[model samples]
Target chain A: MLRLPKFEVKNPSTVEEAIAMMHAIDGEARFLAGGTDLNPNMKHRLFTPERVVALGGIEEMFGITQQEDGSMRIGAMATLANVASHAELGLAYPALSQAALLVSGPQLRNMGTLGGNVMLDTRCQWYNQTYFWRSALGFCMKKDGTKCHVIEGGSKCVAAASNDTAPALMTLGAELEFANATGRTRMPIADLWQADGIWNKKVAHTELLVAIHLPKPSADQRGAYGKLRDRGSIDFPLFGIAIRLDLDAQGTIFDAALCAVALQARPWPLKKAAALLCGTKPGEESFTEAVEQVAALAAKQCRPMPNIPGDHEYRHAMVSVYTKRALLAAANGDGPVHHV
Target chain B: MRVFRLQVNGDTVEVAAPEHWTLLEVLRYKIGLTGSKQGCDKGDCGACTVLLDGVPTLACLSLAATVETSAITTIEGLLPAHRANGGEGADPVQDAFDRCGALQCGFCQPGMILSAKALLAKNPNPTSQEIKQSLSGNLCRCTGYTQIYEAVVLAAKGEQV
Candidate 1:
C-alpha cells in the first residue's frame, strides 16, 4: 500500500472558516474538495502539504440552484455524479453533463467534485507516477527535478490539460466565481488558464473557486460532447471535443463553437472552423459538406503532442473524427457521440 | 494521531488513527473490519467501496476525519442485516453470486456486491445496462463479467438462482 505523508485535516463549516484555517497554518496548506485526485497525488509524493482544509462540511457550497437573472449557479462542491445526472442542468446544458458523465468511472464521479474537476492539475505520463517510478528518471521539471521530458530539455512544462469538462464549459461560455480573504470575484472560464502547463490556472492558491455560473442558453441552442479513450470506462480521454450549435427560427445554423482538450496546457478553441458552419441546416448536403470541411480544418489546425501517454499520431487522427461526430450529434439534437 | 467516532456496520465505535490515514486504513487496520479491500490505493479501483449514508463512496479516497460522521455500511453488515430482517443465510445478492459461479477469485466481490446492493435497493428491477453501469467501477479479472451480470440479473428477479 502506498502511504500518504502525514498531514492534519481541518473540517470547516463555512467557507470563511476554511479560508481562516488555511491562513492560520504556518506550513504548506491546501484546500481539499473531494480527495479523488488530491489523495492519489499525495500518495504519489507529488504534494506534501502539512495541512489540508476539507471543504466537505461547508453546506452552503453543495447544491444546484438557478440565479434570478436566468443564469445557473452550480455550487463548486457538488459531486460529479450529481452534476452529471441533475435534471434541470442536463436539459439546459447537455455538453457539460455529458462531459461530467464521461470522467474516470462511477465511484470517482460520485466522490469527485465539479470544482476539483475544474481545478484539476495538468497531467503527464512522466509527472503522474509513483515516487520510485518518477525518481528512477530523476524527476521532471514539474516536480522536484529540473529536466523536461515532454519537450526534450525545454524549460517549459508541457503537461496536457486533461480535464474533460473544461472544453465543454469553455464552449458554453461558463463563468467562475471565486472567494478569498479579500472578497469575491467572477471571471470567464476561458480566461482562467495560462500557457504554461506546470501551473495552468491564473488564480492564486488562496482563492477558492466558489461556484460555476452558466449563462442561460439561447432558445434553439444544441450541444454535444465526444470522448475517445482506450477503454470503455475508467480511462481519461486521449482526445475530447465539445460542440455547440445555435439555430435560427428557420432551423439554420446561426452560430457555432468548438473546443478541444488533451492537446497541450490549455483547451484550444477552433473559431475559424466554427465560422465555416454558419447558415447550414442539419442533414442537408451543405451542412454535411461544411462539417467535413470543419473536420479537415481541425485536423490541420489542432496538433496533438506526446505530453500525455498515447501515440501522438493516433491522437492526432482522432481530432477530425471526434470533431465531425460531435458536431453532427449537436446539430441533429442527438446525445453525446460516446461509445461505452 | 486523533480520536474520532465513526458509525460503521450500524455500530458506533471510537478509533484512533493518524490524521492523514484514509477511512480505508482505519476500517481495515484499526477497526479490524477487513471486508473493505484496498486495491489501487488511489481512487482507481472500487475494491474499497462502502456505503456512506446509503450512497456508494470510495473509502480509500475519503479522509478519516472528513467523513467520520457518516453512517458507514461495509460488506460484513449486509448478511446480518438480512438475517435480522428474517431472511435466509446470506444476502440475496451474495447468494446469487455464489450460485451463478460469479466468484472466481472472490477478491473483488465485496465491493462489487456492495455496489450491486445499492443499485438493487434504489431500483429493485434494473436492466442489463443499469447493472453494468453500477458495476463499472469494480474490476473483475477472473470472470470476464458475464457471470457477474447474470448474478445481478438473477438477484433482481427475486429468484433463488
Candidate 2:
C-alpha cells in the first residue's frame, strides 16, 4: 500500500485567504483542489510538498454563472462532473462539455476540478511510474535522472500533454483568471501552456487559477473533439483532436481553429491547416482537400517521442484520422461532441 | 495533528488525525467502517466511492478536513430505514445484484452499489448506455459487466431477490 507522505493541510475559507496562505508558505506549499491528480502523483513520490493548502473549502469558487452577454464564467473549484452535466454548457459549448465528460471516468470526473484538468501535469510512460519502477531504470530527465529515455541524449523533456479539455478550451478562445497575494491576472488559455514538460504551465508558482471565461459561440459556429486510446475507458489519450468552425451563409468556412493533444509538450495548434480550411466550401472535395493538407502539415508539426502508449508511428497516423473526423463532426453539428 | 468532526452514517464522530489523512483512511482506520474498500488508492478505481451531500464522490481523493460539513453516506449506511418499520429486505440495489449474479469476486460490489444508488436517485429510469456511463469508474474484473448492468435494471424496477 502506498501512503501519502505527511504534510500539514491548511483550509482557507476564501480566495484572498488562500493566496495569503500561499504567500506565507512560499515555495514550500502546493494548492489542493480535487486531489484526483496530485494525490496519485504524490503517492508515486513525484512531488512531496511541505504543506498542502486545501481550496475545496472556499465557497466563492464553486459555481457556474452566465454574464448578460451570454458568455459563461466557471469557478475553478467546480468539479468536472458539474461541468459535464451543466445544461447550459451542454447546449452552448458541447465540445467543452464532451471533453470534460471524457476525462477519466465517473469517479474521477466527480472529484476532479476543471482548473486541475486545465493545469494537468504532462505525462510520459517513463515519468508516471512508481519510485521503485523508475529507480530500477535509473530515472529520466523528468525526474532525478540526467538523460531522457524517450529521446536518446535529448536535451529537454518531451512528455506529452494529456489534458483532454485544454485543446477544446483553446479552440474556443477561452481565458483563464489567476490570483495571488500580489494581484490578479488574466490570459488566453493558449498562452497558459509552455512547450517544455518540466515547467509545462506558464503561470507562476505563487499564482492560482481562479476562474475561466468562455465567450458565447455565434449561431454559425460549431465544434467537436476526438480522442484515441487503448481502452474505451480510464486510459489517457494517445491522440486527441479538437476543431472549431464558423461557416458563412454560403456553407463556406469563414473561420476555423484546430488543436491536438497528447502528441507534444503543449497542445499543438494546427494554424496552417486552419488557414487552409478558411474559405473552403463544405463538400466532399473541399473536405478531402482540407484533410489532406491537414494530415501533411500535422505530420510535420507533430513530433511524438517514444513515450506513452501506442506505437509512435501509429499515434501519429491517428492524429490525421482523428482530425478529419473531428472536422466532419464540427461541420455537421453532432451531439456528445467527442468521438473515441 | 488536527481534530475533525465528521458526520458519517448519520453519526457525528470526532477524530484526531494528521492533515495528510484521506477520508478513506479516516473512515476505515479511525472510524472502523471498512465497507468502502481501497482498490487502487487512487481516483481511477471507484472502490472508495461515497456520497458527499448526496453527490457521488471519490473518498480516496477527498481530504477528511475539507468535507467535515457535508453529510457522508458509506456502504455501511445503505441499510433501508424501513427495516425499523417492519418492511423487510436489503436495499433494492443489493437485492437485485444478488439475484442477477452481479458478482464473481464481490470486491467491487460496495462501490457499484453506491454508484447505482446515486444514479437511480438522480434518474429513476436510466438506459443501458447511461448505466454503463455511470459505472465507468467502477471496474468488475470477474463479472463481464452484463450481469452488473442487468442488476441495475432490475433494481431500477424495484425488484427484489
Candidate 3:
C-alpha cells in the first residue's frame, strides 16, 4: 500500500477561505479539488506537502455557465463528466467536449476536473514513479536529481505533457482565471504556459486556478481533437492533437491553431503547421503535409526516454497519425449541426 | 485524523480517518469491508472499483474524507440478506452474473459486476462495443471477457443467460 506522507488536510468552503489558508501555509500547501492527480503523485512520494487544502466544499467552483456573449466560464472544480455532458458545451464546442470525454476512463472522467486536467502535473516516465523505482534510477531531473537523465547535460527537465485537455483548450484559445490572497487575473492559455518542465505554469504558488473561460467559436469555426494511445481507452495519449480552424465564407482556411499533447513539457503548438494551412485549400494533401511538419517539429522537440509508456519512435509516428486525424475531423464539419 | 462518516453496505458508520487515506484502505483495513479488493492501488486496475454516488470510480484513487456525504454501494451490500424472501429483490445484474458463469478465481468479479451494474442502469441497451468500452479499464484475467459481456447484456434485458 502506498501511504501518503504525513500532512494536514484543510477543507475550505469558499475561494477566499482557500486562498487565506494557502497564504498562511506559505505555498507549502497544495490545493486539492479532485484528488485524481495529486493523490497518486503523493502516493509516489513525488510530492509530500506538509498541508493539503481541500477545495471540494467550494460549491462555487463546480458549474458551467454560458454568458449572453456566448463565451463559456467553467468553474475550476467542475468534473470532467460535467464538462463532457453539458448540453451547451457539446452544442457549442464539440471539440472541447470530445477531448473531455476521451480523457482516461469513465470513472476518472467522473472524478477528475477540467481545472485539475489543465493544471495536471507535468509527467515523465522517469519522474512520475514510485519512490522505490526512482531511488533505483538515482532520481530524475524533474524530482530530486540536479541533471536530467532524459537528455543528459540538458539544461531543463524534459517531462512530457501528460495532460489530455491542454491541447484541446489551447486550440480553443481559452483564458484561465487565477486567484490568490491578493486578487485575480486572466490570461490567454498560450501565455499561461512555459515550455520548460521546471516552471511550466506562470501562476504564483499563492494563486489558485479558479476557472477556465473558452471564448465561443465564430459561426464559421469548426474543430476536433484526436488521441492515439496504446490501449483504446483509460491510457494517456501517446500522441494527441487538437485542431481549431476558422474558415472564410468560401470555406478557405482563414485562421488555424494546432496543438499536440504528450509531445513536450506542455501542449506544444505547431506554428509551422498553422502557417502551412494559410492559403492552402482545406484538403487531404494540405492536412497530411501539415501533420508531417508537426510530426517532424514534435520529434525535434521531444526525446522520449525509456521511462514513458511508448517507445520514442512509436510516439513520434503517432504524432503524425493523430494530427492528420484531428485535421480531417475538423474539415469534415462538426458543431451543433453535427451531433458529435 | 477526522471523523469520517460513510454509508457502507447500507449502514452508516463513523471512523477516524487520515488526511490522505484512500477509500480502499478505509474500506479494507479500517471498516473491514474486504469484498472490495485492492490490486493495483493505483487507478489502473479495476480491483478496487466501487459505486460512489451511483457512478463507478476507483476506490484506490478516491480519498475517503471527500466521500463523507456520498452514497456508496459496495459489492457485499448488492444482495439483501433476505433476497430469496424478496418482494424487493437482489439486483438482476448479480443474478445474471451467477447464471453466466462470470467468475473463476473470483478476484475481479466483484468490481467487474459493480461496474457492469453501473453501466446497465444507465444504458439498458448497450451494444457489445459499448459494453467492452465500459469495461475497458477493468482487467479480468479470468473469463476472457466473453461471459462478462454476456452477463451485462442479459442483465440489462432482465434475462438470465
Candidate 4:
C-alpha cells in the first residue's frame, strides 16, 4: 500500500474561508476538491504538503447556476459526474460533457471535479511514478532533482497536460472565476496557462478556482470532443482534440476552433487549421475537404513528445484521425467520438 | 492522531487514526472490516470502492475525516444490510457473483459487487452498455469480465441462481 504522507485536513465552508486558511499556511497547503487527481499525486509523493484545505465542504462552490444572460456558472466543486449527467449541459456544451464523461472511468468521474481537471498537474513518464521509481533515475527537473529526462538538457520542463477537458474548455472560450484573501477575479481560461510544466497555471496557490463561467453559445453553435487511447476506459488520452463551429444564416461555417491536449504544457490552439474551415458548408464537399485540411494541419502542428506514455509516432498519426472525427462529430451534433 | 466518528454501514462508529489516513485504511486496518480489498491504493483500481452518500466513490482517495458526514457502505455492509431487510444468505449481488463463477481469485469482486450493487439500486434494469460502464472502474484480472458482466445482469434481473 502506498501510504499518504502525514497531513492535517481543514474543511472550510466557504471559498473565502478556504482561501484564508490557505493563506495562513501558504506553500504548505494544497486545496483538495475531489481528491481524485491530487490524492493519487500525493500518494506518489509528488507533493507532501503539511496541510490540505478541503473545499468539498464549501457550499458556495457546489452549484451550477444559469446566468440571466444565458451563460452558466458552474461551481468548482461540482463533480464531473454531475457535469456530465446535466441534460442542459450536454445540449449546450456537448464537447465539455463528453470530455467530462471520458475522464478515467465511472468512479473517477464521480469523484473528479472539473476544477481539479482544469488545475491538473502536468504529467511525465519520469515524474508521476512512485518515489522509489523516480529516485532510481535521480529525479527530474519538474520535481525533487535537477535532471531533465524527457528532453535531455532542456531547460524548461515539457511535461504533457493530460487533462481531457482542457481542450474542450479552450474551444468553448471558457472563463474562470477565482478567489483569494485579497479579492475575487475572473479571467479568460486561455490566459490562465503558462508554458511551465512544473507549474502550468498563472494563478497563485492561495487563490481558489471559484467557478467556471461558460459564455452562452450562439444559436448556431456546435462542438465535439474526440479521444484516442489504447483502451476504451481507465487510461489517459494518448491523443485528444476538440472542435467547435458556428454556422451563419447561409448554412456555412463563419467561425471555427480546434484545440488539442496530452502533448504540451498548455492546450495547443490550432487557430490556423480552424480558420481554414470558414465559408465551408457543414454537409458539403467543401467542408469535408476543409476538415481533412484541418486534420492535416493539426498533424503538422502537434508534435507529440515521448515525455508521457504512448508512442510519439502513433500519437502524431492519431492527431489527424481524431481531429477529422471530432470535426465530423461536431457537424453531426452527436456525442463525443470515443471508442466506448 | 485524530479521533473522529465515521458513519460506516449505517453505524456511527468512533475510531482514531492519523488525519491523512484514507477511509479504506481506517475501514480495513482500524475497524478491521477487511472485506474492502486494497488493490492499487491510489484511485486507479476500484478495489477500494465504497458508497459515499450512495454514490460509488474511491475510498482510497477519500480522506477518513472528510467523509464522516456521508453514509459509507463497504462490501461487508451489503450482506448484513440484506439480512436486516429479510434477505437470505449473502446479498443478491454477492450471491450472483458466486453463482456465475465470477469470483475466481476474487481480489476485485468486493469492489465489483459494490459497484454493481450501487448500479442496481439506481437503475435496476440497466443495458449491457450501462452495466459495462458502471463496472468499468473495477478490473478483474483473473476473469476477462464476461462472467462478471453476467453476474451483474443476473443480479439486476433479480434472477434465482
Q: Which of the predicted structures, 2 or 3, would earn the higher DockQ when compared with the native? A: 2
**lDDT values for all models:** 0.90, 0.85, 0.79, 0.90
Clashes of each: 0, 0, 0, 0
- Tens-digit lDDT track of model 3 for A305-339: 54357887876755655666677777786421111
- The collision pairs in model 1 are none
A-chain TM-score of every model = 0.98, 0.95, 0.91, 0.98
Flag regions of model 2 displaced more than 4 Å: A335-340, B80-86
Candidate 2 similarity to native, TM-score: 0.96
Q: For candidate 4, lDDT tens digit of each residue in A223-267? A: 999998887878888888888899898889999888999998888
Cand. 1 Cα-lDDT: 0.90
CAPRI grade, predicted model 4: high
Q: Can you write out model 2's per-residue Cα lDDT over A22-112, one digit (the tens) per residue?
A: 8786457888889988888888888888888889888878899999998899999998889989998877787788788788888788889
Ranking by TM-score: 4, 1, 2, 3
Locate the minimum summed-lDDT window of 10 residues in model 1 chain A: A331-340
Collision pairs in model 4: none
Best by DockQ: 4
What would the per-residue lDDT of candidate 1 be over residues B38-74, giving only the tens digit for each residue?
9988877788999998888899988998878799999
Cα RMSD of all models vs. native, in order, equals: 1.1, 1.8, 3.1, 1.0
